[model samples]
Target: MTTSTAAPPPPPAARAATPPEPPSAGRRRQRKGSMRRREAITGLLFVSPWILGFLVFTLGAMVYSLVISFSRYQLATDTARPAGLANYEALITDPKIAIALGNTLYYAVLAVPLEIALALGLALLLNSVRRGAGFFRTVFYLPKMTPTVATASVFLLLLNGSTGAINRGLAAIGIDGPDWLLDPAWVKPSIVLMTVWGVAGTMVIFLAALQNVPKELHEAASIDGAGAWRRFWHVTLPLISPAVLFNVLVLTIAAFQIFDQAFLLFHRTTGTGSSDASLFYAIYLFEQAFRQFNFGFAAAMAWLLFVIILVISIIQMRVGNRFVYYEGGDR
Candidate 1:
C-alpha cells in the first residue's frame, strides 16, 4: 500500500504523448481543388450557349458596326473610307437629323409619361376591384396580347381621314376629326394615341406590384390616423416607384425604337419622300441605312441611341434610391 501510494505514475513526457486520431471519412474532406474545378466547368457549361451566341452573332457584329461607323459603309460597296468622325459631325449639324431628334424626344416625352400615368391609374383602379378581378385583368391585358400587326389594320381604319369611325364620331359631335395619319402635325400624335392601347402589360405589372404590398402597412398607416390620400402618397407611391421606373425605362426605349407604327402608317397614309415630321428614331434609322445607303451613319445613330438609353438607365437607377421603398429599406 505504501509502495502503491508513493507516487502516481509519472505524467507522460512530451516525447511519449499519444498522437491525435485521424479523421473518419465523414469528417474528412477532399482538398477542394477538384470540387472547384468541377463547379467552374458546370457554370461554364450552363452559360455556354449564351457565350457562344454572343461571341459569334452579337459581339463581332457590334464591334464591326462600331468600326464601320467611323467610315462610310454600304453592303454593296467593298471599300470603306474613313470619314474621321464626319458621321458624328453630320449627326449634330444636319437639319433633317435635328428634326428627327426633336420628333423622337417629343414622342418619348409625351408617350412615356402618359403611358406610365395611364398604367398606374389602371393598376390602382383594378387593385381596388375585388369581384370579377380575373375578368377585368384579362380585359385590361388583352390589348398587349394582341399582335401589333393585327392592331395596325384596325388602327388604320379608325384613323382614316374621311370614312374612319373616329371622324364619324367627331362629325356626329360637330367636331371635325383632322387627318391623323396624313397631316404631319397630327401623324405623331396619332402614333402616340394608337400605341397607348398596348400599354396594358405595364398596367398588369403595376397591378402585380400593388397587390404584393402588405395590407399591414395600410392598416398601420390608418391606425396612425393617415388619410387615404396620405397613405397612398407616402406608402403606395414609394413602394410602387420601382415598378413605375421599370415601366418608364421600357416605354422610353420602345418609344425611341418605334418603327412599325411609323412605317406602316407612313406606307399606308404617306408614301416616303421625306417626313421630317413623322421622323421617329427607328424609322429614321431605317431610312438612313437602307434608303439613303448610309449604313455607317445609321450605325453611329444606333450607337448614340444606345448611349442615350444607358445614360437614362443610370439616371433612373441613381434616382430610384430616393423614392423607391423596399421592405427592409431603412437599414
Candidate 2:
C-alpha cells in the first residue's frame, strides 16, 4: 500500500566522508614555511634601522674610543700614535682623578637614595589620586621636561648665597642657609638638589610599576587586620621592590656619569663657579679631552668608567635578584 520512491536512491552515498584531500602534508608545510619566512623578513626590515644605527654609532664609537685610549692623539695632524701604558698609568698617578672620583662617588651616595625615596613618595601620592591625575602628573613631570641649560640658569639665581630665594625662605623660617654654590660642603648637596628636581622621570616609572600591583593583595592584607603601614610594608613594598631595584640601578649609573648639570652649574663660559667642589669625573674627563687636548687620557678615563659601570651593574643585578620578588617567578 506504500507508493514510495525508495527514498530518492539513498542520497548518492553521502559524498564519501573525505575533506577535499587537504593539499598534502609537504605542500602545507611549504606554505607555512613560506609565510614564516615572509614574516621574518618583514621583522628584520622593520628593525634594520636600529641595528644599523647601533653598529655605526654606538659600537663603532666604542671601538674607536678603545683603540685611541692606548694612543696619543695629535690634534695638529689629526693622527694617533702609540703611547704604551702611559695613559692608563696616569689614571692612577693623577691627583685630579682621585678628587674627581671622590666627588662623583659622594654625589652618587647622596643622590641615589634621596631620588629613590622622593620618586617613590611622589609615585604613591600620584597613584592614590582619584581626580585630575593626568594634570598632577603633567605638572610633576614639567621639571623633567625643562632644559638643562635653563634649569641651571634658574638654579644659579635660586642658589645665590646672598639674596637667593632658598636663603630667603630659610631666613623667613628662622634658619640660616649655607652658601649653596660656593661652599665646598654644600656644593655637592646643591647639585643633588638639582638632580632631585628632575626626578619626575623616575617617579613616572614608579607610578607605572605601582599601578600594575594587584589591589587584591592590599585588600587581603587589610582583611587580615593589617593596618595601612603594615599593608604597605608587607604587601606593597615587596611587589614594588623590583621597580625600586631598577630605579636604584639606573640612578646609580646616571649618577656616575653626571655631567650636564654639574658643567652648566659650575663650569660656565664666564669661568665662574666652584670648579673644585663640582669637579666630577666627567667634567675632568671633558677638560682632559677638549680643554687640555689630552685625548688619550680622556679615552682611558672613559674606558675606566665603562669598566666601573659594568662591574657595579653586575654586582647590583646579583644582589638585587635576591631581594626583588617576581610574581611569575625569578626572571
Candidate achieving the largest lDDT: 2
lDDT by residue (206-232, candidate 2, tens digit) is 999999989998888889999989988
Clashing residue pairs found in predicted model 1:
none
Model 2 segments beyond 4 Å from truth? 1-23
lDDT of 2 at 270: 48
CA lDDT of each candidate? 0.84, 0.92
- What pairs collide in candidate 2? none
TM-score of each prediction: 0.85, 0.91
For model 1, what is the C-alpha lDDT against the true structure?
Answer: 0.84
lDDT of 2: 0.92
